[model samples]
Target: MDPTLFSSIDFYQLAKREKNAQKRIRLLALAHVKEGKPRDEIAESLKVSRSSVNNWVRRFRCDGLEGIGNKQRSGRPVYLQPQQEELLRNFIESHKLSSDLPPLKGKDIHAFLKHYFDIDYDISHVYRLLKKLKITL
Candidate 1:
């Protein structure tokens, strides 16, 4: 292995602070490789495929340390924009304070979103969004 492939600073520091388990293992594997351990030995000890170790090494070489971390995933986009979400949050909060309005429920929120935003979200997702918005009801 080329000595220049590894960073001068310890890879262990990156592994210690890594929140993702897969990335942490990859960092540990690279650290072992930096310590002059054979790729097969590192792979066996880490219980990952040698090809995966090879890929990690390749990525690190091409892009440096940031390459080892998880890439951005393309998942479902947020149904509401930040300002819209804030407006909805305020509406819920103000409704909570008003005696005339009934207690807000998941179904009520679901209906409100459909009526106003024309966005129909799952009942479970509505609750999740409310929790994310820190709306108590």
Candidate 2:
């Protein structure tokens, strides 16, 4: 497959901005692939399996950047809807620390999600949710 579908510079910036570790690795692998590096060589350098590198390249070829993103699966529906997610991000951003209010903690965010969205996730999952949303703790 021609690896120039995405330029090295494009992948570099995308990987730089990506907060998720797995996605960042995939992005970097694609970047190397775009630079015409051998798949096995790129895999060894990235510390991932060669098959994974090949799969990522195939995904990029078929769907560009979007191909590397999380895919839909058969499972329970997400408790937090996409619109609610946007609202949650807005709410977090708006609630800045002040003399009266302290910085938001995981429990506080959990409470907020539970109260406002009427959804309850385990406290541990709350951290995972935050990471998935690219929101820092």
Off by over 4 Å in 2: 1-5, 76-137
Question: Candidate 2 at residue 86, lDDT?
Answer: 97
**Tens-digit lDDT track of model 2 for 35-125:** 7899999999999999999998788888878888878789977898899999888877777634467788889899999999998889998
TM-score of 1: 0.69
TM-scores, all candidates, are 0.69, 0.50
Tens-digit lDDT string for candidate 1 (10-109): 8899899988899999899889988889999999999999999999988887778887888999898888998889878888988999999889999998
Candidate 1, pairs of clashing residues: none
> Against the unseen true structure, what C-alpha lDDT does each candidate score?
0.88, 0.85
